[model samples]
Target: MKSGDKVLETAGILVPKVCILGVTITLINKTTEYS
Candidate 1:
C-alpha cells in the first residue's frame, strides 16, 4: 500500500511538469512554423 501511495505521489508531481513541458514545446513549434 505504501509503495502504491508513493507511486501515486510521484505521478501527481510529474504529470503537471510533463504537461507544461509539452505545452511549451508545442507553442514553440507553432511560433517557429509561423516565423
Candidate 2:
C-alpha cells in the first residue's frame, strides 16, 4: 500500500522531467537548424 503511494509519487515527478527533456531537445534542434 505505502509502496504503491511511493511509486505514484515518483512517477509524478518523472513525468514532468521527461516532458522538459523532450521540449529542451526540440528547442536545441530548432536552434541548430536556424544558426
TM-score against native, each model: 0.93, 0.82
The lDDT of each candidate is 0.99, 0.98
The residue pairs found clashing in candidate 1 are: none
Clashes of each: 0, 0
| Model 1: lDDT to the true structure | 0.99
lDDT per residue, candidate 2, 10-34, as tens digits?
A: 9999999999999999999999999
Model 1 stretches astray by more than 4 angstroms: none
Off by over 4 Å in 2: none
lDDT of 1 by residue, 1-35 (tens): 69999999999999999999999999999999999
